[model samples]
Target: MTQERISLFVDHIGPFDAQKIGVLRGKANSGLELLNGHNIEVVQGFACEFDRLERFGFSPGAKIGSDFGDLDMALVQITRSKVETKLLVAQAWDATRVGGRIVVDGQKTDGIESIYKALRKLGIEPDTLVKSHGRIFWFERDETRPFADWLEPKLKMPDGFATAPGVFSAEKLDKGSLALIAALPPLAGHGADIGAGWGFLSRAALGHEKVTKLDLIEAEIAALDAARVNIIDERANFEWADVTKTSGRFYDFIIANPPFHTERTANTDLGVAFLTTAARNLKPKGQFYCVANRHLPYEVVLNELFRNVAEIGGTSAFKVFQAAQPRRL
Candidate 1:
């Protein structure tokens, strides 16, 4: 079906880029670009848990998922929740410059129908379209104030708190991560927590007598915030980064409940990357430990990366493993 609107308005800020906000997030890296003669801020997060996006100034860290660099319209991709869908739609509705538009996209399984239903509930009409079984909808509204202006005045993104519609663990704890925390050994000296979602494992590691210094590495900005709060201590160091992209000092011990999927699709490559990186980034004679879905094909990478790999434990939803390296970090 033809869409009623073609775009959505959003906070134009994230990852420092010369490209306009649209390009920064959706397009490629690097370019001289902006909007309305103003440099747009393009911000992004995998799984929609981003919260640091609120800080003002030139952001050099927002990872771009879609290039929204030069569109007169705004677009918000919600992969997690319908409430968030409503929030985004409401914001888009109130932000458009009369005749401007906004669009929302989501997988049908992710509750796209519910979002469409909610829009109808709001009396705001949408022109619907479909893609790969996913749904996309658009709407237009009259002149409205800056959308953020209508949100609670003086609202601030809380530390350790970042969220977006439909992102896993956006509202609270990640159950798998929590289980991993309950299983971790006491940490010591310096350690790194791989795929440390929202800093849960890293925080648990902090209770150990060792772990004088802890590196909490996560790819999502919002999760980094959670790690920051949960690991609030002088020894904690937070890195908002992809674990596989790490370039840093090796550690005495490394722990993780490595991410295994992007949405629902099983992505063994991500686990392999984590395992390989854990091996590469661990200190010689140190240990690398992780928890994973029992069904993931991670043994090959684990065997290749460590001097020794052993199954430590598991549950219906997870499996735990421990690895050690004889090679120098």
Candidate 2:
């Protein structure tokens, strides 16, 4: 559905005469080929999308840095967060050259209509085309940068953690993670926190006096950046990696609050993949601690992968598990 919307928008406005084009928040299958003959630069933060784009021979970046400010055209892909979508639009405007075109595309479910209305409210009327249950709007950048202020709002949590608009649990510590932290036993030696968002779980894990080192593995660059800021301890090692994929290192212990959704709908397969990776990356005697929603069917996989699995603790909304002695594949 996201690919179809991007293709429809690209097909609607093609054969561009621009020399350079910028795509913000693009995914792996974002139909980037439609602009084949142009010098394209993608701004994608998610590690999965960034790795996929790199594998496909595109030089994609994780952030819209200051060096990417002279594009002849810029495209903004709307995300689930309205504030993040608006921030991408502001970035598109900032990256495009004066008099250059800035295009925004998103599904109706992603609040495309709201963005259109908000743009109009800012005194900038954009030419729009509606199709594929989405909208593609474009406007030329002018000398007056009305969206400048939109880029200045940074979300700082009450605990002084710096999070961005689109990062998971940006506003506060996730309840499931909190539950996992509460249930965590004193960890020691080299351990890993899979899908560690903003370093909350890793920070909690590091509270144990015996814990020598904790790797905070996160897939989102934005969240990893926050983790870098939130966790300043020398014992915390940060890694930008997809938790679903296998890593070479074996850990003494592993903790996770695996994400269950990649899109609007819940995907149990993602959590399953995380479990698979955890099993694969654990030492034979390593322990794995995880927390998930109570309704999620993680117990079966946990039992299949570990010799012993038990519900350590949790509330009605979440469940914390402890699994030891991973089965060798």
Evaluate residue 297 in candidate 2 and report its C-alpha lDDT on the 0 to 100 scale: 92
Residue pairs of candidate 2 with colliding backbone atoms? none
Superposed on all Cα atoms, the candidates' RMSDs to the truth, in angstroms, are: 7.8, 1.6
- Which lDDT tens digits does candidate 2 get at residues 6-98? 667677776668899999987666677777889888989888888999888888988877788898999888898888988888888888889
Q: Write the per-residue lDDT of candidate 1 for residues 1-329, one digit (tens) a residue.
A: 11211121122223222222231122112121223354444445642223333332334336433333234455555545555455555544553345655666666776778877866765667776665656766666555443443233232333445443333566666666666666666667888887776665676788887778988877766567656665669988887766787755678998888777765787887788887788787778778878888778677677777769888767788778888873433
Off by over 4 Å in 2: 2-14, 154-158
Quote model 1's TM-score. 0.72
Runs in model 1 with CA error above 4 Å? 1-41, 47-72, 143-167, 171-175, 326-329
Q: Which 10-residue span in candidate 1 carries the lowest summed lDDT?
A: 1-10
Write down the TM-score of every candidate. 0.72, 0.96
What are the per-model numbers of colliding residue pairs?
34, 0
What is residue 293's positional error in candidate 1, in angstroms?
1.8
